[model samples]
Target chain A: MNFNATLIGQMIAFVVFVWFCMKYVWPPMMKALDERKKTIADGLAAAERGQREHELAEERARESLVEAKQQAQEIISRAEKRAAEIVEEAKADARTEGERMIAAARNELDQELNRVKEELRGQVVSIAVAGAEKVLEREVNEQTHNELLTKLAAQI
Target chain B: MASDTLTSGEYIKHHLTNLTFGQHPDGSWGFAHTGEEAAQMGFWAIHVDSMFWSVLLGFILFYIFRKAAKNAHAGVPGGLQNFCEWIVDFINDTVRGSFSGRNPLIAPLAFTIFGWIFLMNFMDLIAVDLLPWLAQLFGQHVLGVDPHHVYFKVVPTTDPNITFGLALGVFILMLYYSIKMKGVGGFFGELAFQPFPKWMFPINLILEGVALIAKPVSLALRLFGNMYAGETIFILIALMYSAGIVMAGFGGLLQLGWAIFHILIITLQAFIFMTLTVVYLDMAHQEHH
Candidate 1:
C-alpha cells in the first residue's frame, strides 16, 4: 500500500538471512546428501561382493562332492577286483589238492595189487605140490624141493 | 461487528490501511490513524505491521534452517529437518537449473526469498480480519486506543514497499554481478549498445536501459499486484459476512473457494519470483550480450 523504511528493513533482513543460510545451512546438508549417496553405493558394492563369494563357495562344495564320489567309486571297484582274485585263487588251490590226493591213492592201489599177486602165486604153487605128493604117496623129497619151490614162486 | 457502524467504503478502506507509524505535519511522530494521515507522514512513515510480520517470518526462517544445519548428518532426517531440507533442495535445484554461475550466494539468496515471500503471502490465506481484529482488541483493551484506529495488514507481499524491498535487493545483486563479471564499462556498454550498432548507441541505451530497470519494477510490481489483488478480493469477500446470515454463509463458501484458489497463486508467485531471480542473476554472470 505504501513505500517506507520497511523496504530497507526487508532488504537488510534478506542480507542477514542469505548470509546465515550460506554459512550454516546449505553446505552441511549437501555434504550429508552426497555422503548418503556414497554410503549407499558402497553398501551395494559390498552386497555384490558377498554374493559373488557365496557363489564361489557353492562351486567349491560341489567340486569337493564330485571328487569324493569318484574316490568312493574307485575304492569300491578295487575291493570288487580283489574279491574276484581271492575267489579264483581258492578254486585253483582246491583243484591242485584234489589232483595230488588222487595220484597218491593210485600209487597205493598198485602196490596193493602187486602184493596180492605174489600171495596168489605162492598159494597156487603150494596147491600143486600137495597134488604131486598125493600122487607119489611119499614125503622123502620135501626138504630137497624146498629151494625149487621157492624159486618157482619167485619166478611166478 | 463494530465495523458495521462504518459504510462499505470505510470498511474496505479500513481493511486496506496499514499500521503506519510516523510524524505528522504538526511535527508530532506517532502511529497514523487513517490512510490520509499515513500519506501525510510522508516517506518517513514506516508500516509497523509489515515490519513486524516480515521480521518475525525472517526470524522463523533463520531459526528452522539454523536448527537443520546444527543437526545435519547423513542419516534419516527428522520432521523439521526434513522440511528444511526439502526447501533447501528445491532452491538448490532451481539455482542449478537457471543459474549457471557457480556462486554459493545464489542458492541461499533464492532460498531466503522463496521462504520469506511464501510465508508472508501465506498470511493472506488467514481470514483477512483475524489479525487486524486481534490488533484492534489489544489496542482497545490493553493500550486504551480506539479499535478503529488500529490497522494491521498481515500479508507483507501485498505491500508495494516490501515487494520492492525484495526486488530491489535482487536488483542490486544483479547490478553488482553485472559489474563484477563485466567491468563497469562493460555493464554500461551492455545497456548502451545491444541489439543495435555502436553508432546507434542512444536508441540502444534507451531500449536496454528500460529493459534493465523494468526487471526490478516488473518483479516487484508483479508480486505486489497479485498479492494485493488477492488481498482486496478477500477484503471484499469479508464485507459479505456482515450483510446477512445467508450472505455470511455464501461468503464463507466463497472465502474457502478463493483460499483454495489462492494456494496456487501464492505458490506460483513465490516460484516465479525465485525463478526470475535466478535467471536474471544468470544473465548478469553471462559474457554474451
Candidate 2:
C-alpha cells in the first residue's frame, strides 16, 4: 500500500494522543480515586476512634458514679452510727440527772422530817412537866419521871 | 456537479473515502484526499458505524434494564429478567476472562462496548443494498436528490477510519493502564528494558519502541481490513449479478455463501477487537512481563 503523509501524520498524532492519555490523564485519575478511597477509610477510622473514646469516657463515668455511690453509702452509714451514739449519750445523761435530782429531794425531805420529829419530842416533854407541877403540890421522885420519859421516847 | 456521471456503486465508494490533510508536493503542509477520514468530531470519527449502533443499542439496553429492575421480582425472574441477566453474565464473564486488574469501571465499559459493537456488526446481516436502495426510492421519487447520485454506506465498520478509530481508542486505554500500574519512570523503564536482558538495553529499547507502535497499527489494520474486505467482496458480487453476466447465478450463490461466512467474520472481528482490548489492559495492569 502506498502510504500517504496525511495517514502518517494521523498515525503519529494517534500515538501521541495515546501516550498523553496514558501518561497524563489516566494515572492522576486513578490516583485520585485511590486517594478518595483512602480518605474515606481514614475518616471511618477517625470516627471509630472518636466512638471508642466516647464509650471509654462513658464507662469511666459509670465507674466513678458507682464509686461515688459506694462512698456516699459509707458516709451515710457512719453518720447514722454517730447519730445513734449521740442519742444514746443524751439518754444516759438525762437518766443520770433525773436520778441525782430524786436523790437530792429525798435527802432534803429526810432532814426536814428529822427536825420536825425533834421539835415535837421537846414540846411533849414540856407539856408533861407543866401538868405534873399543877397536879402535884409536892415534888415527885426522879425514877418515876425517867420511866415515863423513856416510854415516850420509845413511842416517838 | 461531476457526481452525476458516476454510478451508485462508484458514488457510494467516493463518500466512503477520506479527506486528507497536510503534506503537499511542494514540501509544505497541503491538503490531499485519502479514503480514510477521521470521524467528524475531535474524539469520534464519522466512519464508525459500530459506535453509532453501539451507543444506540447501549441506550436501549440501559432502558430495558432500568425497566426490568424497576419491575423486578424477588422470586423467579420474568422473561425480560432472564434475557437481561444472560447478557449481563456474558459481559461479566468476558471481563473476568480478559481483565486482570480489579477495575469497577472496565467491566461495565467492556460490556457496553461489546453490546454496542455486536449490534453494529449485526447490521451487516441486513441486505447490503436494502437501505441504500430504500434511500434512493425516497430521494428519486420523493425528496428528489437524484437516485443516480444518492450515496450512503450503512455499514460503519466497512470504513477503515471507523475501525481504526476504535482500535485507537483501545490502544489509548492500554497505555493508560500501563502508566497507572507503573509510574511514568517505571513505564519508561519497562520499554527500555523489555524483551531482552538489561545488558542489551539500547537494542531492547529500540525494539520495544517499534513493538509499541506496532500494537495499535496491527490492532487497527486487522479490524479495518476484515470489515473492508468483507464489504468489498459483497459489493463486487452484487455488481457481478447487476452487470448481467453469464456467471450471474453463480455470483449470486457465491455472494450468498460469502454473506453467511461473513457473519462469522464480523462477529469474530468484534470479539477479537474486544478481546485484544481486554488483553492490552491486562498487560498494562501487569507490573512485570
lDDT scores in order: 0.88, 0.63
Interface RMSD of each: 1.2, 11.7
Point out where model 2 deviates above 4 Å.
Answer: A1-156, B1-74, B141-143, B245-248
**Which ten-residue region of model 2 chain B has the weakest summed lDDT?**
B36-45
TM-score of 1: 0.84
Each candidate: fraction of true contacts kept? Answer: 0.78, 0.00
Candidate 1 chain B least-lDDT 10 residues: B1-10
Q: Model 2, range A45-130, lDDT digits (tens) per residue? A: 99999999999999999999999999999999999999999999999999999999999999999888988887887777666656
Residue B253 displacement (Å), model 2: 2.7
Best by DockQ: 1
Worst 10 residues of 2 chain A by lDDT: A1-10
lDDT string, candidate 2, B99-173, tens digits = 767976565555545554565666666776777677558867897655654444566555555556556666777
TM-score quality measure for candidate 2: 0.54
lDDT of 2: 0.63
Query: What TM-score goes with each of the models?
Result: 0.84, 0.54
Stretches of model 1 off by over 4 angstroms after superposition = A51-156
